[model samples]
Target: MSKLTKYLKITKGVRVLDLACGRGRHSIYLSTLGYKVTGADLSENSIAYAKKFENKNLTFMVHDMTQPTGKDFDTILNLFTSFGYFEKEEDNLNTLKSIKKDLKPGGRAVIDFMNVHFVSKGLVREEVKVVDKIEFHIKRWIKNGFLYKNIRFKIEDENYDFTETVKMITLEHFQKYATKSGLEIIDTFGNYNLDRFYEKCSERLIVIFK
Candidate 1:
């Protein structure tokens, strides 16, 4: 929140859109700070959960991130690596275009993504974790310009498997998307603390643009 206050330069009553907000954590926080915030997500369950915290200044809705949520928001936030789930590159680019369309003329946006180079260099191969009495076997790998994670877990007599995939998008790739979407890259940080971004060492690719 401190990083947002600094980078976005937002003030009280500023309109904010939390795009792809899973459960409205950020929206709730910003609303408490006096911002008018709307948290939108694709999942109905997530929206329902988030709605429990809604007040006059905060709300949640089910909306697709690849489409325009609303018009003329002062700030738009796409955090926690939520921008790269689409399978096609065009879909990913469209998401940026949607954000550009929804923002006010001078509106700002923050995209919190993973640093591709850092993740590739320090990729974890395999690991096992036990959570709530369930053992999860996890494996990670990079292939064909995408990062992949396979998770397998069991509960009692049932088996479950899931795969998470994200495109290995670098700063250069995002620059192209921003240009095409009529947005400019203004600043970038390595992590939540707003440290200067180092391509090879940074853990996050947090871009601030307008």
Candidate 2:
């Protein structure tokens, strides 16, 4: 996050929007650095939890990723793989457009997304785990270039299933969406260390746009 703030040229008194922020971790941290911070998330519980940190320079609210915010900000952060949850590609693109719309002129958007190529390379077929008396049987695979996960859990004889699918959106895809949204790609980093990205070797694909 420090690296991200530096890249975005965030300084004291700047307004920052933590889009899809979960529990306001980054928002609260940014506010401590004297930046006005607002965290928006789809989860009501997360928003409620985040409100505990609210103060003069910090706030949180429920927000949908596809919708534009009423205010613009000097920096917008979508961190920790907080994107690509939608079922449709268009929905994902709209989220990018909303981020572009919510930024002030010359403002930067920092998006932290998974390095799909690397994940696909290390794809785990199946596994089992027991945590807190619950057993989880997990399976992962790639189909049509999209990663899918299905976790079957059993707790005290009760079973449940969870499904997740995220499209393998590459940097090229990002460039396409950014161009369509009237934004320009400025930089791309591989991980928190700020290394240059390698599609096959990088652990993450952190992108910056303006």
Candidate 3:
């Protein structure tokens, strides 16, 4: 949060929209810093959980990020690699357009995504985790320009399985998206500390734009 404040030059009372805010952690923190924040996500359960922390300065709602949530936000944040969920590139581009549409004039936005190069080079193949007496078997791999994670677990005689996929978006791809969305790329950082981004060495692809 300190690094984010520094990067955005955020001040008290600024209006912020936490887009795709899974559980409103950032929105709650920003509200505590005196910012008026609204957090929106697609998950009803996540929004319900997030609403437990709401106050006059903070709120949460269910929203689709590919569409405009609201207007005139001083800053919008899409953190924790919250993007790249859509299978279609056009939908991903539309998400960027939605962010551009929701911002106030001269408003800034941040997109924190995984460094594709770094993740591809260090992909973990498989693992098993036991939590609260449930054993989760996980497998990960990259295929057809996307990263995939498969998870299987059993609890109380029931079997659960899920697969997560995220497009391997690079800085160049984001630059193109920014141009198409009428947003200007102001800065790019490697990590939370704001180091210069190195495609292969960086752990994150953090883009600050307006």
Candidate 4:
């Protein structure tokens, strides 16, 4: 888990709701810190994998965050650039509204998103990595506020390739939508450590709201 997430979980008796929690990484960390955590994602496969780490304070469920939810929570987390995965802008805004509805009064939220401007300015057209005997290569860039990332994995016997594109909106866009959803932006961090925004620098925009 990221240190920023650990900082957020320091509140006492917090009930944390993690949206689109693939594999329950942050949820598990929050749970270990004594915060009640519920992780929701659409992938049953990911949920099944996360179940391997089940504990008394942590739970996982299948949920499409673009829709409505009934559970009330004290703090909601949308981490790791998961907010822009939905193609429809209205769906994303409505999801924020739904999150506000599910939050307890005086509750807060943490939304971590990619810094689109920085990425667009300093886009990495190609990158590569190696894991064990497998070589993983990626080609990523931004065009018209949409981020395109293509991956090619080469193993000893086989190769696999896939591409994922997300609408890369800026931090101002989220502030607008979150304000319409009744959540006020309390603070913005350039990355996990809370720095100022700059062109061609920083990868994440961490927004705290209430």
**Residue pairs clashing, model 1:** none
lDDT of 1 at 65: 85
Write down the TM-score of every candidate.
0.98, 0.95, 0.97, 0.89
Q: For all the candidates, what are their Cα RMSDs to the real structure?
A: 0.9, 1.3, 1.0, 2.2
lDDT of prediction 3: 0.93
- CA RMSD (A), model 1: 0.9
User: Whose TM-score is greatest here?
Assistant: 1
Q: Write the per-residue lDDT of candidate 4 for residues 110-143, one digit (tens) a residue.
A: 8888887777778779989887867789998777
lDDT per residue (tens digit) for residues 1-210 in model 3: 788887688888889999989988888889999999999999999999999999999999899999997567999999999999896889889999999999999999999999999999998899999999899999999999899999999989999999999999999999999999999999999998989999989999999989
Give the clashing pairs for model 4: none
* Local distance difference test, each candidate: 0.91, 0.90, 0.93, 0.82
Q: Considering lDDT, which of the candidate structures 1 and 3 is the better prediction for this target? A: 3
Q: What lDDT is reached at residue 111 by model 3? A: 95
**How many steric overlaps does candidate 2 have?**
0
Per-residue C-alpha lDDT of model 1 across residues 36-82, encoded as one tens digit per residue: 99999999999999999999999899998889875679999999999
Total backbone collisions for each predicted model: 0, 0, 0, 0
Question: What lDDT tens digits, residue by residue, belong to model 2 across residues 75-165?
Answer: 9989988888787789888998998899999989988999998998898889998888777899998888688899999767788999998
Candidate 2 regions with alpha-carbon error over 4 angstroms: none
For candidate 4, give the lDDT of residue 10.
51
